[model samples]
Target chain A: MSGKLFRNFSFLSATLSFFLLVGIFAILFTYAQDAMHAFGIDFLFNETWEADEDDEGGVFGGFIPIVGTLLSTIIAMVIATPLAMGIAIFLTEIASPKISKGVSVAIELLAAIPSIIYGMWGLFYFAPIVQKTVGGDGVGLLTAGIVLAIMIIPFMASITRDSMNTTPLVLKESAYAMGATKFEVIKDVIMPYAKGGIIGSIILALGRALGETMAVAFLIGSVMSLPHRITDPTTSIPVLLANNFAEAQDLEMSAMYYLALVLFVVSFVIISAAKFYFFGKKAK
Target chain B: MNRLFVNKLILGLSTLSAVIGIGFLFWILITLSYKGITSIHWSTFTNDLVEGGIRNLLVGQFTMAILASFLAVPLGMMAGIYLREYGHGSKLASVIRNLSDVMMSAPSIVIGVFVFALLVDPFGGYNGWAGIVALAIMMIPIIISTTDNMLALVPKELREAGIALGGSKHKIILQIVIKAAKVGITTGILLSFARIIGETAPLLFTSANNQFFTMDLNGQFPSLTVSIYNLATYPDEASRELAWAASFILTMIVLCINLIGRFVIRNKK
Candidate 1:
């Protein structure tokens, strides 16, 4: 009877906790619905954001911000993925354990620093450096993208290294015994085995890049239009939300809310997919 | 001979990139310190933010962070405890865990916007209390995930042993289970502290920045992060220098917290 009572209590608490968790999503969905009703689907595709009064005739195209987000994130991935993979291969396959431990800790410390510091550094030091070297205005998609790549490299490298390390040692040894070169063994056996984890890490990093705000806000000049060149001034969705939500008119506020909802959904899907791919089977 | 040299060359190139990456991080720290450390004097700590000092901002950050952690840790621990211990195959538990994961990864700015909509706009003014609420919401999911992870690490045999001793479920958790997981729990709290201390975007909408010192949780307050943002943008080089200094201070606090957390966990083993 005591055992049964304990079990029932545990079940009750678990159920209550779950309901609370789902409640957060429900609240987000309700807010999204209200925001959508206020603006309609046009809120998403509209680009013009004239929040000023008297002349409220601007269309609500969100393409610029969306493009800004995708462009910077893609740029970051392009820069970070190769470096991260190289670092991972170096750490797991080549470095001695003592050196690897030290390097790993240093990378983890990089991850723990605040995003705002990154913003401050970018605004003060990095932006000027870029402006001087690139021979143009500092603020653009390229600058923001490079800063993000540096910020995210540690995240991607650590995860990739862990996954690569998990590759069966025996398999690598057998390939080596058969006279396969180190690079050949890695390309053939290790990379394939860790493919799921590597993909998951990239997806996670992409999610982070899409959602980052303070750093991007500092680097990306808040031009609401899409740039034809990577070095052209542009605005991302998160930066727009940060810039506009403070003094937004009612319609603009609702539109910003809609944008926020879209961002939330995109990140939610990416993270959920990564989780399912990486941990779903083991979870059962 | 050429092929062998080529392999060595490839290895050297990869090693060089890794060294460069590590070097970049140290460069940032050294630069920040050089720019900011000169301003770290006595007057800076005793004066208010309006007078070009961060005394009030420092106090406000400490107070708000502690309050938010106080609210977040208990509730998060309860939720985590419930999920890990009581949640077997329950649909509700699975949903909650998934939602918590999503919430954990949601951008800090989104949380700010949500809190602004839910609390500040309705209240018709920015308040420190609203900021606290926002930070707490951000902290909760992290705490819950950490606590659940730590609890999961507790051995099944220990739990069974407690059960066999005629202790109630709650007693078992309160006594045997949590005691074993104390180091992990402390690490979670420390990580949460590190996380909330540096957050800026969420506070942007929830707690409007104040130049003067204010202590009331219901009143406007300035934090280290908001102050840094405000300072970094000023036309004055002094303010920019101060911002770097403040950034250094904030980073030190976070690094110390993380190091202490690791130490605690390591010592426990």
Candidate 2:
């Protein structure tokens, strides 16, 4: 009887984290009620992000940060997807198995490298080089996007490779047996079958690019205004929260939670979609 | 043929693209080593951030990481065992499994906010312990999934062999399957550790940053990643150089962990 009870206890402990996630959403929602009540729809639409030091009323607007997050994520996805696809193709199709495994390990390590180091490299090394050519102070949206692209390439590439490789060997061989060239087989057979999964990887990459803080925080121009060009500096929602939360007082702190909430919800949708597609492939 | 030329061009670009991607990794490693290796002041491991030593922050960072691992490793493994051993195909298992995957990819900042709201809010300030909770939260899902996946890979034949000897479920799990999958579970734990070591965003809101030495868990504590951020953003050249050192240390630590983990996994196979 005691052993059975202990078994049940272990199961209960396992479920606690799922409950913890639910609790997080609840706590964030409750705390955000202040900003929710104050800003109402304006929280989602307003662009200005100012807060008076003593005002205590707190600033609450989502427009610029939301736009910045979306724009940078878009930039990252657009730039990373093709490069990732290229790497994935080369690895799966061109490289020897041993070389591919070595590169694969390298790519996996790339994904594991923490975000802060990437931020430091971008700020110190990549930004200066970009600044020289862009004709502006280089730490801006474009640089951030480029660094983000580099950071996410391994993730997208590996995912793309895995999904693409799932296309059956027999199918590819049959295409080859028809006198189809390598390009013909890839374009006609592999690409079509892997389309949904490749897309899923990109979406997952999008979620990553959106919530990333350290890497973009340095390179992206941290400002309140809209980025007029990719070269212009901007602040992502995560950046805003990171830069402000420590300094924020009372209601302002709650407003930052609202920003976290927004980021959380956006990532939730994209990540879920990506998981749905990527894992759902296995079920089939 | 025209098609052959186009194919060759595409293949060349793909290889070039892979080269560029791998090239960046080497470039960062080389640059970090070049600058950071020369700045090896033994004092770095002993000094406070403002005083130019990263000893306190490193301690604080590891304290949080170790505490988090202690918290996450068990619960995550339990969750994994539950999913694999008992709950497979159950509605609760499926929901939890999917949710765990989603949470595995959840934004670190969001998890920080969650713990900050849940723990820090009640305490009225940032402290080292709150950061531990946040970091632990991030580690849980990864460990859970890895535990589940690794334990599943333990052959059914092993379990049945133990069962034939009249072993209870718990005994079979603890004495047999867990032992078999020990290496994988350790790899998962180490990878999760590496993932959180250089984390800055979550620490930004939870532990915040401490410039001076303080070992107090419930109070503000110095942390390496946060210090790197603070140092890197400073306008002064000295601070930036220190930032590179910190980056080098962090990158090296993470790389070493990865190398060790990969080597171990390879050896296990």
| CAPRI band for model 2 | medium
Q: Residue pairs in steric clash, candidate 2?
A: B47-B53
Candidate 2 local lDDT, A1-284, one digit each (tens): 35576578668867876897788788888888888888986788888777776768757688888888888888888889889999999999889999999889888888888899899889889999988998668888889999999999999999999989999999999999998877788889999999888988888888889999999998888898898887888888888887877677777777887888888887888888887765572421
lDDT of 1 at B1: 65
Off by over 4 Å in 1: A1-39, A55-58, B1-10, B89-91
**Ten-residue stretch with the least lDDT total in model 1 chain A:** A13-22
> What is the overall TM-score of model 2 with all chains considered together?
0.97
Model 1 chain B weakest 10-residue run by lDDT: B1-10
Q: A127-161, model 1: which lDDT tens digit per residue?
A: 88988887558988988998899889999999999
| Global lDDT of each candidate | 0.81, 0.86
lDDT of 1 by residue, B1-269 (tens): 66466557666766776886797689778877787798676777888888888888888888888999988887788777777787745776777777777678787887788778777888888889888988988888888888888998999899999989988877788788888888899899998889898888888888867888888767677888888877888899779877887899998888888889888887888
How well docked is model 1, in DockQ terms? Answer: 0.47
Q: Give the per-residue lDDT digits (tens) of candidate 2, residues B114-147.
A: 8777778789888898999889888899999899
